[model samples]
Target: MTDLAALRAALQLQWALGQEILALVQREHLALTEPGQRSGSAFEFFRQRLHLLPRLEEAVAALRRHRAAWQQLSPALRRSDPEIGALLRANEDLIFRILLLDRENQQLRLRHGLLTVRAESHPHSNRSTSGQFSALA
Candidate 1:
């Protein structure tokens, strides 16, 4: 059917776009790690590289729509097209795993940031305690 064809095209386009965005992220990450490359602050580098994640998510959502449409096809059609089913399932799994890994990485980064802030603030507490008695006079 025409609708099926359109969905397939859309899914393929979404997958290709996601791959392209991931490639760009990889390239930017590698460039940022090169020695003596004082291109920008770490936060700025991370911001630029991370900008692709939302675009990837959008592409994954589009692909999921296509996959749902494919699943709703008649049983006979699905039985006759095993490759479509397999590819759809595989891509879905891959995207889901990527998103899960991204979330875990974000959580770890947040924990690291909290630890860094705590370490930086802890020394100030010692200084404040040492001066507290003198200031109370």
Candidate 2:
């Protein structure tokens, strides 16, 4: 296959991988938010997603390396490689969404301390010795 064809294929693969990673992240959030849910499945999904990282990175790197060659292609060739523009736009949108979701996840982790809870009946029922609310109280 031509370099354009290879790059286009790579872009498609990366897009698919990105979508999978996003879905896994959403699943992880679900695992976090549900009161009785187990996080093991989400952790497994994360492990699977991690296995895909190097392939995704290689595909992205290959595209970057071939970008100069891509710019040299004729307009017709560029237009024929539809994956280029579509993947670019989709990637941009996905990246923005992923960043927003990741930030929210970080905040959730900090706020709930990974959803840890004590045997106390009420959240405000326990107070520290100084009359201050603390997670460890």
The lDDT leader among the candidates is 2
Alpha carbon lDDT at 62, candidate 1:
69
lDDT score at residue 129, model 2, on the 0-100 scale = 21
True-vs-predicted CA distance for residue 56, candidate 1, Å: 3.1
10 residues in a row with least lDDT, candidate 1: 128-137
For residue 131, model 2's alpha carbon misses the true position, in angstroms, by: 35
lDDT of 1 by residue, 1-137 (tens): 32655655665666666566444434433434453644554465356435655666576666667677777789887777676666676667656554544434333434444123433444436542112111100
Candidate 1 regions with alpha-carbon error over 4 angstroms = 20-41, 114-137
| Per-residue lDDT of candidate 2, residues 33-94 (tens digit) | 78476565534644554565465456455556555566777889888877776766676576
- State the C-alpha lDDT per candidate: 0.51, 0.57
- In Å, residue 43's CA in model 2 sits off its true spot by 6.1
lDDT for position 33 in model 1: 46
TM-score: model 1 vs. ground truth? 0.53
